[model samples]
Target: MSYDAKVFNVMVASPGDVLAERALFREVIHEWNAVNSEVRKVVLMPVGWETHSSPEMGAGPQEIINQQVLHSCDLLVGIFWTRAGTPTTEYASGTIEEIEKHIAAGRLAMLYFSTTPAVLDDVDNEQYQTLRDFKASCRSRGLFESFDSLAEFRNKFSRQLQQKLNAHEMFKLTQTESSSNQPVSDFMRLTVPSLTHEAKVLLKEVSQDPHGRLTYVRYIGGAAMQSNAKSFLDSKERREVAKWENALQLLQEEELIVERGHKGEFFEITAKGYEVADTIIS
Candidate 1:
C-alpha cells in the first residue's frame, strides 16, 4: 500500500546571536515528527539560512537569501535576542525581511523574543534598540510568544507545535490518540504558567547557588536579592530594588522556590526549579 504525507517547510529566521537556541527550535520539530508524522500524514522540515542558503552574487545578501529560500517558506519563525540583524535596503534586518516577505505572502509566522539578560556593555546599542522597537511593534500585528529560559522555550515550542497542527488547515492533525503504546508524558507541564524574564533569570541564578537560595535582606537604607555569590541590587534606589524584589516574589508565587526558614528572607529552589535550571544553565 502506498501512503501520502504533506511536507511543510519551517523557515527559521533569526539574527546570529541566538544560534544556540535556533537549533532547539529544529529539535522540537524533529521530535514531533518522530512521534506524530506517520499518524498525522504530515511532516515538518526545518529550514534556515545557515542550512539552506548558498553562496551567490546577483543581488544583496538579504535579497539573495530571499530569492533562495524565503520565497518558498511555509512557516516563518522570527527569533530575537540582542541584535535585530544587519539592515537591508527595505527592512530592519535580514531576519525581519524574511518574516515580512513570508507574512506578506499570506503565510503563517511565529515570533519569539528571548528575555535572558544580555551584557549591556557588549550589546550594540543601535541594534539592541532596533530589536526593542520591533518587539513592541510585533505585538500590534499579531500573536507571539516570549521566553526566558531554554527549558521554557522547548516546552512552549512543543505545545505550540501541537496547537498549530490542530488549528492550521494545511497541517490539520488526524483525530486520534497521540500514541497508544506509550505512556502519558510526565514532562508535559502544559498547565505550568509562564514566568517573567526577570523571575526566570533570578531563578536560574539562584539555582546555580551552592545553597540554591534566594534571600532578600533589608538594611537601614537599602535592600538586595543575593544568590549564587552575586547581588542584583546595586544601589539604594527604590525602583531597582523593587524590580528584583518582584522577581523574588514571582518565583515564590510560581512555586519554583520555597521558603527555607523565614518568609521573604530565605527561599530555596524547589526540585522542579532545579529541573528547569538544568536545561538553561548554558
Candidate 2:
C-alpha cells in the first residue's frame, strides 16, 4: 500500500537499565514500518558502549552518537526498569543528555516502561536511587508509561504509538481540506486592531500579488483603493477578492510562495504551490 512521506520520526533512548525492554521497542518500530510503507525507516540508537575503550573519553563518544540521533528524530521513547542499586555499567551520562536535549527542543513525546522496584534491590543501592530519580523526572515531564511485564509494555507501547500516528494523519487531512476550501473573505474578516475592513481587504489583495510586492500604482491607478475597490466594492466582489487573498496567504505561510524583496513585498509561489493548488481545486 502507498504511504505518505510525512511519517513521524521516532527516536528510542533506553540506556542499559532495561535490557529486556529494547525488544518491545524494536517490535513496535517494526510493526509501524511494515504497516506504513511511506514511513522511512525507524532508527534505534545504541544505549551503551559495546566495549570500554577508555574512561578518559568521559562519555564523549556516546554524547556524539546521542547528538546525531536527536538531530534527526521527532520523538523520544524512554524505557525504565527498577533495580535496588544503579548498575555501574548502565547509566551513561550521554544517554541522559540526549533525553534532556529532546525535551528542550520541544519534540519530546516520551513514553516510559517501568518494572518492579523490588527486583532492583539486588543491584547497586545508589544506582537504585538513581533509577528512582529518573522515574520521578519522567513523571514530572508527563512521560511515564508503567508496565507490570514485558508483554504489557509491548501491548501499551504499540497502542500509544498507533494513537499518535492516527492523530497526526487526521490533523494533516483537516489542514489540507481547510486550506483548499477556505474563502478569502473569511480571512479578510479578521480584524487587525488598527486596520479598517477596506484597508484589510486592500492589504489582502496586495499580499496575494504573484510579484511579491503590491504594485497598487500599476494595478489600482496609483491609489490603494481607487481602482479595484471602485470596481469590486460590491459585497459579491469583495467576497471573491477575500477568498483569493485567503488562499494566497495560506500558500505563502506554507512556503509554497517565497517573498524575496525587502519586507517580503515581492513574491512567487514555488512549483509545489501550483501542484497543491491544482490538487485542491481540481
Candidate 3:
C-alpha cells in the first residue's frame, strides 16, 4: 500500500548504566508502532548516539550527536538508573545537555529515574550523587517520572505516549477527520473519574446493573466488587464504612446516581453514571 505517515523522531538519551532501559525504549517504540501505525498513521522513530554514525573527533562526541541526531528529534526520552554519565565541555553530562537543549527549544521530553534496588558494590558514589543533584535541578526544568521497575516504566510510558498523542492538535484533527463519517461511540461523551476508589467502584457497580439500579445495602456491603478493588470500605471498621457512605451521598448530590425510597434502600444509576462508567470500562 502507498501512503504517507506523519513521522516523529524520538531521541533516547541516557548514560551507560541504563542499558536495559535503553533497549526497552526500542521495544516500547515498536509496540506503539504495531498498534498506532495503521490506525493513527503516525510513525515514531527512535534515535540515539549508539545508533548514529559520526566522525570520531572534530567537535566533541555530544556536539556531533547534537548535529546528527538529538537536534532532529521531535521528542526526547531520558532515563537514569545510577550514573549521571561522563562530563562534556559545556555541560555536566551529555544526557543532561541533551535534555536542557530539548527543553530550551520548547520541545517535549520525558525523563525517568529508576528506583529499582542496585548492588552497593556496583554503584559509584560520586556518579550516583551527581545523578541525584541533576534530578533536583530538573524539578523546575521540566516534568519527570520515577519507576520502580521496567514493568512500571512500560505501563507509565504507554499512558504518557497516548496522552501526548491526544494533546497534539494534528493528531486530534486526524482522528476527527477519520471518524467524522462514522456513528458516535457509546463512550463519546464519557467523563473519566475525579472520585475516590470506593466511589468509583460503587458508581461502576450501579452502572453494570441490568436495570440501572442497585440496592443501597448491597452497594455498601461490597456485593460482587471486583477482585482488584482497592477500597477497604467493606471492612467492619465504622470509620471506613462512614467514608463509603459519604462518597455515596456525594455521588447522589452530583446527580450521577439517585437514592430512592423513603429509607434510601435503593440507588439507581443515572445517565451521568453510565457516561462515567464507559470511561473506565471502554
Candidate 4:
C-alpha cells in the first residue's frame, strides 16, 4: 500500500485580486496528485506564502518569503487578473519577484492572465497598467495562456499540466530514475506536438455530443464523420480528407476514442477521452 514518489513543489504566484483563481490552483494541484501521483510516481506539493512560510525576522518581508517558499519551488504558476501585486523594494510586486527568481533559477513556469470582466470601480488604475506592461513583456519570452472564465482556466491548467508531466523534460525528475523502468517514451502520445488542430477540433466536438460517438459514413461524393449533424470530415479533396481522417485515427491510437462498431463506422469517446478533451477544448 506504501510507495515512494518524487515530490515537485509548485509556487502559486498572483496578486490579491485573483483570490478565486489562487484557490483553484491549489485544488488542481491536489487533484492532480490524487489522480496521478501513484501512477506517475510523482507528487505535486502546492507551496505558497500562506501555507509554506512561517514568520521570521532579519530580512525584508518579501525576502523572508523568498527564502522560505519561493527558492524551493520547482514549478511556478502565475495568474493575474486586474491588479499587480504589492511592490517590493527591488521589483514591481512580490508575485513578479517570485516569478522572476523562479525563472532565473531555470525552473519551468506557467503564467496565465484572466480576461473575465472586472468591476469598473474596483480596478486599480496604476496597478492595472503595471499588470498590462508585465503581460506585454512576457510575449517575447514565450507563450502564455489566457482565460475568460474560471471554468476555462481550470480546463486549460489541468490539460497543460498533463502535457507538462506526460513528457517531462521541463521539470527534470528530482529523484534518480527508479528501477521500475518506466519507459523510453513516457506518455508521449499526449505530447502537444502530436495533437494537430484538426484532431483538437474533432475531439472537442465529439466530446460534447450524445454518447460521445463519432459516426463514419461513406456517401456517393465523399465520406464523412458525423455526430449531431456536425461533420468532422469537412474536406472533400483527397489530401485534406486524409488529414481529417488521420485525426480520427490519432485519437483512437491515443485511446481517447474507441471504435464502437465492427465495421469501424462508430467511434465513442472514453472517459479518458473526455478528460483529454476538457484539457484541449477550453
Model 1 CA lDDT for position 147: 83
The candidate maximizing TM-score is 4
lDDT tens digits by residue: candidate 1, 1-282:
454567889999999998877988988788667655655566889998888999998789899889888988898888888999999999988888898889889999999888989899989999999999888888889998888876656556655666687778656433333333334455443424477677778888877775566778787878767888888888777877787788777877766787766545877665456555655634
In angstroms, the error of model 2 at 83 is 6.1
TM-score of 1: 0.61
For candidate 4, the lDDT comes to 0.80
Q: Ten consecutive residues with minimal summed lDDT in candidate 1? A: 173-182
Model 2 regions more than 4 Å off:
1-4, 38-59, 83-92, 117-121, 168-282
Writing each residue's lDDT as its tens digit, candidate 4 over 1-282 gives: 886788889889998988899888988788777655765577999888998899898999999999999988888999999988999999999999998888899989999999999998989999999999999999999989999877667656766776787656744453226423655355444433358888888888877764466898777999978875697666688998888888988988877777868999988765456667767844
Ranking by TM-score: 4, 3, 1, 2
Give residue 137's lDDT in candidate 4 (0 to 100): 91
- Can you tell me which runs of candidate 3 are displaced by over 4 Å? 169-282
Tell me the whole-model lDDT of each prediction, alpha carbons only.
0.77, 0.49, 0.73, 0.80
Q: What order do you get sorting by lDDT, best first?
A: 4, 1, 3, 2
**Which is the leading candidate under lDDT?**
4
- Clashes found in each candidate (C-alpha, N, C closer than 3 A): 0, 19, 0, 0
Q: Per-candidate RMSD vs. true structure?
A: 12.2, 20.3, 11.7, 9.0
Candidate 1 structure lDDT: 0.77
Better of 1 and 3 by lDDT: 1
